[model samples]
Target: MKRTDIRKSVHDFVSLRLDDHQAFADDQSLQALGFDTQDIEDLMFRLEDEFDLTAFTEEEDRLLKEAVTVNDLSRFLQKIARH
Candidate 1:
């Protein structure tokens, strides 16, 4: 999937999950958006189901841990799609 599409998906999911209307900025951290560990886990599972792909391969888990913003998740998804 394209990066832009991945980003839009992430933004939409987060906004819907949080019931927030504000646009997501690339630099906005998930922590700043109020996503706790459980929320992040839920989102990871949700994304995995939606994309029919696992998000927790050892390397991907490390990548996920480093992801702090919507853009980061989008980039991760883009990379995953390649493999």
Candidate 2:
């Protein structure tokens, strides 16, 4: 829920390699950050591991494109953890 916690969690998922956190301030588009397609998979896996959530299916992965910020991704993961 807190933006700072969400940002921290996402940065940890990326292994802190997202070179442009400032530009991503309000955007969660992985392509905009130049993250390779598989990098997104890796991040999803990291989130799974971090929060002990089930893996997202291929369809769910595609849905992540709509998530546009660390906060968005965090909320997504929170939804995941809840169910």
Among the numbered candidates, top TM-score falls to 1
- My TM-score estimates for the predictions, one after another, are 0.81, 0.64
**What's the lDDT for all of these models?**
0.73, 0.63
For model 2, residues 1-83, the per-residue Cα lDDT tens digits are 44466567886665476665344553566676777657766776777677677845864576456555556566667667666
What tens digits encode model 1's per-residue C-alpha lDDT throughout 1-83?
66666777788788887755776687898888888767876776676677776654784667657878767777777767777
Each prediction's Cα RMSD? 1.8, 3.3
Where is model 2 more than 4 Å wrong at Cα?
A: 1-4, 19-23, 56-59, 64-69
Candidate 1 error regions (>4 Å): none
The clash numbers for all candidates, in the given order, read: 0, 3
RMSD of candidate 1 to true structure, Å? 1.8
Total backbone clashes of candidate 2, pairs 3 or more residues apart or in separate chains? 3
Please give the lDDT score at residue 75 for candidate 1.
Answer: 73
